[model samples]
Structures are given as C-alpha cells and as structure tokens.
Target: MDVSMARILVLTALAFAISGWAAEEKPMLFSPVSEEPEWRLLDSGQGRFTRQEFENRLGKIFDPTGAMQPYLLFDDGGVTLFRDKARTRPLYRLTFVPEGGAGEVNPPLLGGGDPARPLAGKVICLDPGHIGGDWADIEERTFRIGNDAPVVEGELNLRTSRRLAQTLEASGAKVVWTHDGFEPTTTLRPADLYPEAISYLLQGSLGARLPKYSANRLIRWNAELLFYRSAEIQARARRVNEELRPDLTLCIHYNAAPWPGGRVRLTSANGLVVFAHGSYTAEELAFDDQKFHLLRKLLENSTPVELGVGQAIGEQFQKQWGFRPENYEGSGYSHASGAGPYVWYRNLIANRMFDGPVVFVEGPYMNDRNIYPWIQAGEYEGVRVFAGKSRGNLFREYANQVAAGVIDYFRRQAESSATFTNYSP
Candidate 1:
C-alpha cells in the first residue's frame, strides 16, 4: 500500500477503536474501594454539578456486568474511568447530557437575568502552553521555530493564558485552567523568569563578561526548551477540554518565527487569531463560524492587530522572545494560504473531544523587549500602553469589547434558532 494510504488506514482504525469503546459499554461507576473519596462540588453561581450527581448518572449508564473503578468527574462535566491501578489509559468519557439539566444550561448574558434567578452558565477552559519543569527535561524542551531556529513556546503561552483566565473570571465566566504552573497549582508562573535567572547568575560572574557567547547560547537553548514544553502543555489542555466539556476551550500562546534576513525582531502589537476544529460537525462548524466572525470584530475593535498578523508576530516574537510559532499542519493561517497558522492538527482532537465551541488565541507575542519588564511585573496596564497608546485600560477594554461581541453572537444565534424552531410553512 502507498504511504498515504497506510497512514489513512491507521487513522481509520484508531477512529474505529475509539468509537467502538464508546459504543460497547456505558461508562462504569466503581465505588471507592479504599477510603470513601471526597467529593468536591463545582458551584459556579449559575448552576452546580456535584460529584455525587455525576456518579449517580454514571451508575445509571454503566452496564450491570461491567466492573467499577476510580473515576474523575471534571468540573466541566466530563467523566473518566480508571480501571487499572494506573490512570494511564483513559476509558470512555460521558459526552452527552440530558436536556433541561444543569449540564445543558447555557451562559446567560450580562443583566439578562433577575437577581433572584440564577444566571446562565458557561464554562471556559484555558490551556496555557508549557510546563514549569520543561527546561529541565532536555528531550521534551526542544522544538523548531519558524523553519529552523529552536525556541521554547510553552512558557510564553502559559503566562498569557494565566492573565487571560484572570480577565475572563472577573467578567463572570467560569474559567478552568489546565496545568497551572509546572505543578498543579492555582497560580501561573512567569515563563521568562527561569532564563532571566540564569542570565542574572551569569551576569554576576566575571567569566561571563569575558565571553558573551555562552550567555547568548544559553538564551537560545532556553527558548528551544520552551517550545517543547509548550507542545506538551497544549496536549494537556486538549485532555482537560475533553474531560471538562466546557462551553469554549481557548489555547493561549505567543508566536515566534525567523526574520527575513535570519535576524530576530521584537513587537508589542497585539493580534488575535481564533481557531476552530476543522473536522467539526456541520452544527458545530456553523457555531464556530459565528464565533470566528464575532471574535474578529471584537479583536479588530480592540487593537490594531489584524487577522493575518500571525506570521508577522510569529517572526517578530522569535527575534524578540527567542521562540517560534507552533507548527501544526492544519493551522488555518499558513503562509501558503495567507490565513496564518492559527489552526492545528491537534485542534481536531480538541474539537472531537469537546462537546462545545472551541477556539485558540495566539495573543500578543512577548518578545517585545521594551515591554518585557511590564509583562514580567504583571503590569498589564503598562503592557497595554506598550501595545499602543490608544489601547488604554487593558483588561477592562478587552473585557468590554469581547463581552459585547460574545453577547451579540449568542443573542443572534438564540434568536435565529428560536425563529427556525417556530417556523412552519
């Protein structure tokens, strides 16, 4: 068989394997064999999904003959079964929710509900790129930038996602972040701090001054490490989205690529390139298109960053941040397509695993050395100025514009769907 045909067959088999598992048996529920597991309730004010309720549902779905095991009920309503002592193999996840239940609730618009009535619920999963320990692992810390240079993309992505999460939460969205820091924590660590620390230590040494070569090399090494880590982080984010079943999944990252003359350039300009899963069902695709248009309007109104700025920022960031844009074959925004590399092959995984609309945002690149201090300091206000003098009040301005756009999108969708539902020839 031809190489392409063989690859196609393998993919076909994998799909079958996944679907077969899903169809063979209902998700099983095993009682805590050891000690009674503590159940945590995720109450988002809009509604609540408790572990008990999830287990109860699972019990109903599981086949009577099936064995039970420890399982995880993710905040976004995804349930995973752990059969073996090890949690390596992920059993089937519960994808569908019965109508009119908490799981089926939609996000409410601002001021659309009475104080007494619960607001609409929406789940937003943020995947920050890179793990904290990525630099330490040489094997996992290497990745290509643009086409050649190696750089670390994970660290920058994680930091930006952390900031975005804070902004989204403050805007009344239920935000769940995957891989907080190197370890599992609520706080996000600065991506550039580790390299900066090395630089600091090197600067303190007299030998470092004699040869700038070693210092420059170290910087370049760290950047490559960041890219490898970012890839892992993106994978984890996809897993989390699968388990959580959020309303939207946003993978946040900074872009990097080589300059025309093989030199590096830094930039402060903000660009928003939204990505949707290309293999989505028609219904999901329609929803994504609506979201893409709305996001475009929101971003265009907020910053000078345009749709095709992914490559520009990617190249600029590599020169500035020492990393490269993520290399996903399916990324919609490729140079060949003039769309830029916003979409990725794994994005299909995220979309398939997730039950709702999903998007990836390659926010402003962090290579703009002029704004590095502000970003490192968590001074978003200063960062906004660095983006543009006209871009005042970073979070507030961003929140207002995005919120307005999202609200408008949903309202239109709901209205159109309602009209269609009521229509009769």
Candidate 2:
C-alpha cells in the first residue's frame, strides 16, 4: 500500500484500539489525549505533611465535597493515596508529622524582591487563550451581531496579554508567552485527530450522537473539540510546564453569556471572576490525571500565592471597572475561595497542567449590553466613555487591572516579612 493508504489503515486500527476491541489496550485510561502519569514523581511528598494538614487543605481548598476520600486510606502513620478506590495501584504514601511538628513546606511568596521592583527576579508566563486569526471560527470563540465587527475572544486575550506583559516587564519581571501570535502551538490538525475523536465518541456508546448528526458530522465535531480544547491546551501546557517553567502563569480570557433567544445581541450580564486552581469535582476526582494534578498543586503550596494574587487583581477590577463579582453560585465546577468576590477555586486544563501558581482571569462578559460597544470600539488610543465614565478601551483596562493586581501582590510580598498563609482552623 502507498503511504497515504497505509496511514489510513493504521488510523482505522487505532479506532478499534480506542474502542477496546484490539488486543493491546491504550495506556491512557483517563483524560483523553493525556499520557499515563508516571506515579513515581509524587515520591517527594512523602512525610512532607501532617494528617491534619492534609485533611485541612483538602477540606478548605482542593476537594471540599470529599471526592478524594475513596482514593485515600488514612492511618496513624500516614495516608496512602491510591490510583483507584480498589487500592491496587498505589500512587503515594504521605506521612503525617506530629502536631505542631515541622512539615516540609516551601513558603509561598517570600518577600525578597527589590522594594521598587517587586517582581525583579520573578518570571511570569502569560497565556493568551485560544487561537484567533484564521483559527477563530474553528475555535468557536468568535461571535458577531447584525453588521458589526466580529468579537473574537482570542483577539481580546492577545491584546490584553501584550499590554500586561509590557507592564510586568517594566517592573523588572521577565515575561514569557506560551504563544505570542495566532498560530497553533500544536502541529496536530483536526483531520489528524479524527481517530482519537472517533475513539472518544465510541466510548460513550455505539449509538452515541449519531442521532443529532450523521456519523461523519459527529466525528468532525468531536475532532474539532479535541483539536481546539484537549490538544491545543495540552500543547500549551507542555510549553508552560517543560520549557518556560516560570514562577507563575496567567491564563487570560474574556467571558460570554448566552445571548437571549440565542440571538447574537448584547445583554446586561457583565461581571468578573478569577480562578486559582482548586475545587476538583467528584466526577473529576475519579480521573487519574485529575487526582495527580490535585495532589501536585497541593504539594507545591501554591494556594496562598494564588489567593493573594487573585485577591489583588479582584481589587483592581472593582476599583477600575466597578463591575460586580461574577457569580458561580449554581456552578457545580467552582466554589468561592473565601478570599474575595473575584477569586474562586476551580480546576481547569491550563491551571491543572501548569506546574507553578496559575491565575486564570475571566474578564467582562462579551455579550453584556454595556460592554459590547466598547469591544466594537476595539483598542483605541484614548479613553472612551462607557456608563458616563472615561475608561480605557477594553483591552487596556483588562490588562491594567491584571497587571496592577499582580504588582500589588508582589509589592505586598516585598514589604511584608511574613510568608503567605491560608491555613485556618
């Protein structure tokens, strides 16, 4: 067979492999397109915590719903974190220190930078979410009203990141980008992902969604989702974790609400919410990758830093934009961190995959009647009047608040002699 024909045959076999019909089962059991985790990497966390600390942290920040209980076996000596409820696969053995005993913890946000340049030695990685340019339509992050310029979320994110990076670098911080331009970080196109998408679909059932769309259309839709969401973010995560390895990573995004009647018009639902990577759902905790990341983030001691920075940005948002907190009261995937209106804890692909502290900021709702024109106005040179106050264009304002919050947090760190603390009885 020719190379093209052989490649098709391989993919056809792979589809069966994904469906579990093939003799050799794929190694990845959870989180499609994810590699099977090397469970040994969590070895360092042994004896790094106390039983109280472990339970407290989980109750407070990571798993509030007791989703992790099944996977953890607690005893006087330690807690054995398992890969499954059956406990056949052991992931880590964490020993508890005695009460008031010294548990090894890397203090978060030690105040050491030059007072003026609070971020002097810090490395910040900025991720402008989604691929715009020609990829905008495919990403589904672009929308428009009757005869108006398209409001593309990726465009807004890139603009905001550029301005934020400028401010951060001026404060003596080095700023890196996951991708500076619109091109995708992953080489895999939608066509290349068809087999995996097919496999993903087949997992649901042989009768999975051929009703809504034909087999080809359903496969195409799944291929696009995997391409944009799973594959795309995974590519960015590889860069953030492996290559950049910065002190902190910021994922910038613009929020949107469903337009009334599903029309492409504006609404009055603008608000703000920032995420600091916790709150793994019960369903999510069952996945191996989710469990691995939950512990990894906990072990890194990023909570205080994430909360501090998140609160700072939130303050800036209130002061500058005067928007109310974006409510996630009914949203099962997220919960308030008790830090402030703007800060919430939620597990997300970028935040979960990145190694260090991750601050995911979702700015003004795109479909807000009040903000739609501001978006249509695009990035302009001077302030524009919205709600009877002069405001920088949406891009600059978004960037400024984010940068200010970051700067404020670091400056507070620089002045204080104390390590950030989130532990409370």
Candidate 3:
C-alpha cells in the first residue's frame, strides 16, 4: 500500500482501540450504547428528562456548587443519558432504573378535599425547627427589640407544630413529634460532644484550637453546637431515620434576614420557601455510604416526588398567607427537580441524613415590619383586625398553612395512585 494509506489505516485502528479501552474501563451508567454519551437512567421512563423540563420546571438543571458530571442530555433517537461533559472524553452510563415502566410520571400534588377532616390514614412527622420556650436564648433563636417579648423562632415554630399536629390528628392522621417541647432529643449532651464540637469550631486548625477557658467565637460556637446545632441535628436526624419512620417529615422553621452592621431591625421582606433534597455536595460525596445514599436517592427517582410535594405545600402557603415562592440566585438554591417553582435544592443535614422524604419549610421573616406585631401578639383563636381568621390565633396560622399543605399533598397522592414505595430510596 502507499505510505499515506498505511498511516491513515494505522490512525483509524488507534482510534478504535482508544474507544474500546474507554468503554471497558468506564462502563456506562444506564445506556446500552458502547462509549456513546447517553442518558443516565435516574428512573425508568419512556424518555429522558429534557433540558426544557429542567429549565421550565426546575429553573436550572446543573449544580453550581460542584462539577456537572451528571448532565441529563437527550437526543432525537429516544436515548437519554447523564454524561460528564467536563472530561476530554465523557463517560455516559446507566446505573439505575425502576422495575416498572411508568417511571417518568411526576408524583401528584395535593388537591382539594374535606375541610373538617382531610388527612386520613396518613402518618406524618412534625419536626419543630429548634428547642423553643426557655431554651430559645440557648438556641440563639431569640431576637429582642427593646425586650418586647423577644421574637423567638423556636417558640413560633413549636407553636405552629403543636397546632398542626392537633389539626392533623383532628383530621385522623397519625402524627409524630420530633420534639415535644423545649427539651432536646439528642443522645449525647453538649458537654459529652465537646471534643468533636471544638474540632468543628476550630475549623480543622490544630494550632488554632482554643483553650477551654478562652471566650472566643470557637468557644461560643462549641457551646452553640452542643446545645442546638451539630449535635442537635444528629438527634433530630436519628428521630426521623430510626425512631419516627413516618411516611414524610415536615421540618418547620421561621426565617430571618441578616441585618448588616450587626444591627437587628425589622424589614418588610415577607415571603415563604420550602425545600426537599437533590443537590448532592462534594463533602457529602466524600463519604462512601452517603455517596451511595445520594446516588440511590437520585436513581430511585425521588427528586420529582419531593419537588411535587414541596410545590403542593408552597401553593397552600400562597393561598392561606399570600406568601410568594422563593427564587434564589446561587447554585444549589436555584436548581430544582422540575416539579415546582418553590422547591429549591439544598444539602441540609436533615435533607441529607433523613431516609424518608423531608420538606424543609421556611416561612415568612419573623422580623418583618408587618409580621413583628403579629409575632408579639401571642396565640389566640379567631379572627382579628390585622391577622384575620384565627384557628388558634395568628401563630397557629403557620400550623394551619402546614397542615393544609400536608393534607393537600396526601390528597393528591391518593388521587394519582402514587405510592410511597415508588419513590423510596
């Protein structure tokens, strides 16, 4: 053969060898094609999740905090796959797909039902955000403005939880409480967890370790975690994963905007947001088990379910309190599951550790100029001039909204025949 022809033949053979080697080394996660960029089978569906679906439903498709290794790309050939487009030669593979064929259908949202008794035969867990009442100061949930009954997020959230439980029970749903009152549920006391807490406070700096007697941010942070932070999170997660294996968990918390200049003033910002998992971080992926767990969650097709439920609850919030859905500006905050507008992706411990579905609810800013007075007014039942109808007063309205949301979620699930097992990781 001619010299040029021989060189061309050699190059073609080399290309085939490289492609074959890549296919052997890095197997596809879901696709059947050989070394082709195709969709990762997150869930068994007729087609892959389209980019339009990601943009219109979830606002964004990529995780900003980490590499977009798993890009959901679709083609005209009815093939879908998650590809790590960052690499010089991307790897697309199929890792998981459900047994059933109808995996692409979105979980249904809560619909209208009986007012007196809506949720029946549903098991719900109400996780009040923080230890409230006497421990409000300890949890750092107290915001005092001239000492007028300090705005306590824990107390407000607890009140909301209690009322929500009552409403749920009245409607015939079994309710589990992560925290009954101000008492913490953590197995280890703050002092017992002091060593680990101190390590975290020191931020992994061996030389920067604070003396036990030193009064510094490290010391303060250590104390805070012991009382109601890292340790507290562990305790709460234990309740959800072990003790209370309810169908779903509602993590209730009142939000507060940061005040610049170290000053605390009431702002007019009033709105609401809710979250469900699905933005796995690099830190979480470092652990082998958690990495597997995160992958399982994604593969099991739970994101759509969580987003659907989150959006259902968001709708109820809008209806009852006129709260607007949140639109964040950053990475995880902006990414969603194409199920709802308000359902943003976050890597919270509760969202990460809890085995079951968790809905993290962030209500109106407690210190909003309009909301401050309602917060201080104390709990009451019946309508008032400013607050309107009071089921158990204005604070209870938080519970009312939540209860309504949960009921709405279940009601829709029942209507759509979406079982919990379908989305369980």
Candidate 4:
C-alpha cells in the first residue's frame, strides 16, 4: 500500500477510537431518561444579542447568584460554556450581535386579525397540575378535614383549566392541554423508576434523603416521588416543547401548607403567588441540564414575556382575591420578581423544562381554615356566603381571574407589537 493511503487509514482509525471514547463516557444527567443537552439547538440565537444585553439579562433575571461564572468564558464576540466548573470540556459557543448592531430579523408575527380577537393565532398550553382521580392518594395531593369531602388539588386544577380554556378560546386563542383528564402524562410507573430513584438517593440531593423508612421502603418511596414529580412533568414538557409548542404555557396549581408531624389539618395561613422562572441555586447550577436550560431560557427571551403575563395575573389576583403574596423572603430558591408583591421568580422543574414563556399560578391555600369550607362546598354554581362575603365557587373564581389575566396580557402584547421586538426569541 502507498504511504499516503496508510496515513489516511491511521487517521480514520484514530477518529473512530476518539468517537467511541466520547460516546461511552456519557455525562451524568438529572433524570434517568433525560437526553443530553443538544447544544446546537441554540444556534438560532447566534448574533442575536450584544454582550451588554446578555449581561443585563443575566443580572436582572437569570443567574443572579453568578453560579454560571465558573462554567462560562466570555469574549468580545461570544461565550463558551463548559460542562464542569474547571472548564476542561467545552459545551457550546454562542456569538453575540456586535454592539450597536441589529440582529437577524425575527420571524413574522403569527396572527393578524380583527381587532375584536386580540388573541387570534396565539397558542396557549394549560397544564392542570397532577393526576387527581385514582392516583390522588398515591400522589398525595388530596386532603380531608374531618368528615368533610376530600380536597383534591389535581381535580381542582383540572376544573379550573377547563374553564380557563373555554374563556381563552372565546377570545380567539387556540388552546391546548397537557392533559385533559386524570391520566398521567408519563407512562413510567413507580416500579419502572426504582433504579433511577436509587441513583437519586445516592446523590442525596432530593427531599426525603434522611432515613424515614427502612432501606427498601425508602427507595420504594423515592421511586414513587420520582414517578410523579420528575417523570410525569418531563412527559408534559416533551409535549410542550415538541408537539404543543405553545406561545405561552400555564401551570395551574392550588397551594397547601405543610402538614406538620404527618398530621393533615387546616391552618390559618393563606397566600397567593405567581411565578416566572429565575433564581438558580448553586446546587441546581451544578448540573449540565440546568446549565443548558438557564441559557436556553435566557436566549429564548422568555423572562420579559413571563414577567409581563405574571404582572397582569398578579393584578387580577389582587382585584379578585385580595390575598397577599406568599412571602418567600428567606427562601433560598426564590427571588422577588420586582413586578409586584404577588409575582416572584422561582426555578421550578416545569418552568425549567418547558421552552418559551411560562406562567405558573399558585392558587388559594387549600389548607387554610377559611378555604376548607369553600372547598367542601365543591364546584357549585352562582355565589354563596364565605367568610362573611358572597363569593363564587373557588374553582370558578380561580378560573375567572386566570383567564382575565391571560386576556389582559395578550391585549397589551397586541397593542405593543408594533413597537416591541424580541431580538432573542
């Protein structure tokens, strides 16, 4: 054989060996089924923002704690992200738009219709929290006060979403649902997640890490938690990011205070809060999936939209329920959104996983002594006296305010579309 041919053969063999080594040494990811970050997915954002714009966003919304500093290297033209704090392995390089320059033109707006339909051509995805029917007990989202009827949060969320969907559709927005009924979005049951649960337990990062049961029972218990909390949400995220691809996604949930000493009971505490993603703890930033998402959300320009819709929703809550914001002041995982007292920035799993803007609404406190009676009354018609004031059923009231808030946001977006340009999105 010729020397040139021999050299080419040797180079080809070396390339294959390197490829095999890289493929076999897969990085540890958050979920057992989670695919590694597809770095190239962010290519659309190339030259979409300036360094100043990126830095302002990072300081104002994402990465407030500067946890990303360890993994990121920035230059005049772009940034390089690494998988580890030592920055030995590079993940992706993102170029910035030159200062005082315009980015590539964004795609045309989706809807141009009659003034009457402000939401025309908008796609909204509504997620009704959890599985409430047969799985409520397993999911532990149901509670009972004495002989009174059980208050199931998942069921409540579904009821609220159905109403909200109708309201949004009436305004000319196309509505999609993550799950319409009690069925879980995920097919993986607790048994299927046992191994993942074991791996999670070994990390000792999840809740219930301390021994609360026998070794076998502890692992089994965590498996159940993983199934509902992680796997189920991941499934819904797949739908949101791929199939639904909604302009905005809403995660509707009813809040409950911690049941102390494993005793489920009512409390005097009551509060309301709206969430838009932000506030990454150091621990969360350590993972590559989290690092990827933080950048994706930043470059997607979801924070502005998230905050805008969140503010409108906060107003509705004040006008309707008059509840104070749930104070997360000392909570390490949350930060004040600066939009209002009722809206805060929190990095929740659903918000992190789903692409685009997300508005997470935490409804009334089900465990509040005042709310327990309202819940017991069930999803009834018209108004009834509650806490010395006539009020609509809790579900109806929740739905109305949420629907109103969404409509308000879209109306404003429509009015401002002529002037507003989202360079990153």
lDDT of each: 0.39, 0.82, 0.61, 0.82
Worst 10 residues of 4 by lDDT: 104-113
- Provide the RMSD of all predictions against the true structure, rounded to 1 decimal: 17.2, 5.0, 13.8, 9.5
Residue-by-residue lDDT tens digits, candidate 4, 143-206: 8877878889999999889989999999988999889998899999999987676566555534
Which window of 10 residues has the lowest lDDT sum in candidate 2? 202-211
Write one digit per residue (lDDT tens) for candidate 1, span 10-78: 564576578663522432211101111112211121233334444442232221112233333344554
Give lDDT: candidate 4, residue 373: 90
Residues 360-401, candidate 2: write the lDDT tens digits. 999998889888888888889888798787978888889988
Q: Candidate 3's residue-wise lDDT over 1-425, tens digit each?
A: 24553454456447657767353454332111112222342344334434333333322322445533334443433323332343233323332223333334353333234434557656788888988777677676878898697788888888888888898898778899888887877765555654445334333322234444433444455556555765676667777867888767788898987675569888767877788776655444333333334443443444555676688877777777776676774553345555556678776666655656778888878887777787777875565655443333566777777777777766665654433435443
Identify the candidate with maximal TM-score.
2
How far residue 407's Cα lies from its native spot in candidate 3, in Å, is: 1.6
Clashing pairs in 2: 267-369
The number of clashing residue pairs in each candidate reads 23, 1, 16, 0
Model 1 global lDDT (CA atoms, 0 to 1) = 0.39
Which order, best to worst by lDDT?
2, 4, 3, 1
The candidate, 1 or 4, that scores higher on lDDT is: 4
TM-score of every model versus the real structure: 0.39, 0.90, 0.69, 0.89
Q: Please report, as a residue range, the 10-residue window in candidate 3 with the lowest summed lDDT.
A: 29-38
Model 3: lDDT equals 0.61
Instruction: Name every residue pair that clashes in candidate 4.
Output: none
